[model samples]
Target: MNFTRINGLAFAFSAIKYIRYNQDFTKTTATKTTDPRPWLGLDGLVLALVCLLFLILATGDGSGNESDARLVLTTRRRRVQRRLRILSSVPSALIVFLLGLILCFIRDPTIFSDIKLGPSRFHVLKITWDDFKVGFVRGAVPQIPLSVLNSVIAVCKLSGDLFPGTELSATKVSVSVGVMNLVGCWFGAMPVCHGAGGLAGQYRFGGRSGLSVVFLGLGKLVLGLLFGNSFVRILSSFPVGILGVLLLFAGIELAMASRDMNSKEESFVMLVCAAVSLTGSSAALGFGCGIVLYLVLKLREMDFSGFPFFRSKSEPTAEDESLINP
Candidate 1:
């Protein structure tokens, strides 16, 4: 009878323990399954703060100042030699941008119709966890390469030509700025990156100093906050032809930078790369093809003596030998 009583108590305790364990498990599962906030939540804010701290720690000292100083000296020397004002084009480009904006507004009167003036109807962007994940996977991943190519590689190359003293790193710019933009994307911000065209435009408009970017950012922020809703519509009215013209000039400027390539072999490679780029409609494809072509040309020696055209009646002339050697 005592054994039976002890067994009953033991069973009862076991059952109680199981019940409590199950309840705790259920609570944990429920918490795990709860929907995450769509917008920049506490977690996102924490992540952003961590990133900011990392950047501050990583770039604590101005170790790059010596290079920048040398660049300034070189720039001064170039300016003195060339006798050209770097800021000369800024006014014209600014005027063109303003004119383009005005023309767009003039062309469309109903551009502001969609903008509601009341405080009650303000549109708020809803950014969910799903949105952030999808953006990171789909948008940001793909954009990194494109931004590095178009913004850093192309822009830096062009900048080097236009401002011989300037130096920029493609990797550093892409990693830091790209990551920040990706973080911003979680909060419903459009994915942003520096671009060659934008850089060229800024340069053309006399934006040699870092202050230019600061001023521009401030202007854009003020404008956006004041007329956030109508901004899209206003931009939509810009004349495509005018924009095309701007792009054309930027392209020309970039092309002109290629003049610095002194070697015939390098020039040939560049031409082939350009042709491949035009045909493939992708800079990455062209870059790959160029690398392959350059390697093949460098490694494998080709002899034209086997061809009938090379089997001349007489021995090769000095002129022919000079031409061949040259």
Candidate 2:
């Protein structure tokens, strides 16, 4: 009908597509086991609640003492505002979780049905000198530089785009976290790094303050304690399409942030950077190419400025002005 109606219909269709895409249809021959976790049963309920909330929040008040013409206009404006608020207020995580739940229901997977926690082994306490030597020479020495560079770049790019003006020390924080994770690895913890994808995902999912990190750490702790053996299975069950959507949005947001580079030269450099990045899928290569292009352009500009023929005809050179005057 109208533009507003078309937009609303488009959004509705997109939501349906997301739900359909997440529906797992891989036929399994095994019998489905009953899930004992309280949270497991609440998936559909949560989705319904979220949808109901969205509908309620997105609907505007129609009651007014205005004429029929004014009422229609006012109603449309309120509906638009409500839609914006609903879109902005919904957290990305909720969408991901809903998608995962839908997939789980459709597949009826039982991959985690046999998970059970057992007693820890005592051999983990027996650390040998050879282990330390090997770790130092083989693991730490070669990986540290690359890890540090990745962390610094990720932090700088994310902070520059999403949290500008926030004072964040990339080196100090990266090193500190690296050291902590390194120590944790000695006791069988997985090697961890501050990855760009992780940072982007966090930002995409409504993580703005340091409290988000704290809450994440706390959630991990709780999960590890409550479902030690099942943690891997739980995470592995998430739909791939849902994760792709999250990453897609995160990349879009980061790319859109680069629009602030308004100067023509900077814009050209940015386009080069984007092209190289997309072509190679490497941030380091893209950055290097941008730097090289910028330098080449600068050198060419300097060389052209020095040539008399390239100079603007509106301004006379010192030699030409003196000759004319004489």
Candidate 3:
């Protein structure tokens, strides 16, 4: 349940910012992203187990001082400070979000109840909180944003899962989640996505607590209990443009980290793999892309050898391992 807790907290944090601070009509269109779905990975408990092993291996300490951990701590602390400095620019959004939380705590719920037609002839239906909770649904499949290489891997992974009690594929999961959501929203529940928006909102809001996320759940629950399907309709019907913008920002930022890290050949291979995935969904095409990319790289025919993991292997190593060891 740690995944649920962690992901929940993330969703909650973002919901606060999204519901309270983001007022612009085009709020959804301002960012882009691709948050992994909740169901894709091992359960939180499993992750904790893995983390425990990793931590045990990672820390060379039966005695903390006996290890080289001091240097690692210093490095971590410096990184945190550097990140804090970068975040100082978004004070207004933070302030507004906090204030909104306060107001929501004491204020009587604002309930909208009506239906009408706009001047543009678009149908307008006013709903309440009761309606919004029904909208919780799965996020979209990542096929649109991910490269062919990733897609092939995903498809293979999914194929493997299809045989038995395996984790569901995101593509198929998204459809099922979407179908259920469409039904729930159609009936009168609050809207929820697969978690991209929630993750984006969480990252935006600095929510790292269960309390933070439960508030979002509570808010939707309150709204759902009051207004029912109307609120879900309103949120679900929110302009795709807004979602597009937010997602776009998120995607660019997500990919940015891996952008530079690569084997020039690997990078080129990855790019072609991604590009092919971009153009076609054929089983043969995806396989051909991956295989061709690998073969070409091995032969040194198609070239674009990048640095390791996209980082320039050429960058001067700050720490000379030989010096330390000697």
lDDT of 3 by residue, 1-326 (tens): 11122222333334323322323553476342223223212222233233324323322221122324445657777776555445433432334333333333233233233322232222435556654444223223333333222332333332232223543465664565557656665444444444433433343334435576788788766765665555544454342222332333333222321322345665565555455544534323544676766876577653445545556566445477556675
Candidate lDDT scores, in order, read: 0.54, 0.54, 0.40
Regions of candidate 1 where Cα sits further than 4 Å from its true position: 1-90, 116-144, 301-326
Between candidates 1 and 2, name the one with more favorable lDDT: 2
Task: Say which candidate scores most in TM-score.
Answer: 2
Model 1 Cα shift for residue 43 (angstroms): 48
Off by over 4 Å in 3: 1-201, 209-212, 236-242, 257-260, 279-288, 295-326
**lDDT per residue, candidate 1, 185-282, as tens digits?**
54556667766656654554456678988999999877777677567777776644344334444444344433456687777777776666655245
Q: What is the lDDT of candidate 1?
A: 0.54
Compared with the true structure, model 3 gives a TM-score of 0.34
Clashes of 2: 0
Tens-digit lDDT string for candidate 2 (1-326): 01111122223333333333443335363222232212123234344345434433432221112334545557787776566656556664665566675566456557546455643342344568998899889988766654654555545655666677873587776877778786776678767776544565466556778898899889777767776756566556665445434444444434433325667887788667656654524445666687799899998767575678887777778998899998
Candidates' TM-scores?
0.58, 0.60, 0.34
- lDDT order of candidates, top first: 2, 1, 3
Q: What lDDT would candidate 2 get against the real structure?
A: 0.54
- How many clashes show up in model 1? 4
Ten consecutive residues with minimal summed lDDT in candidate 2?
Answer: 1-10
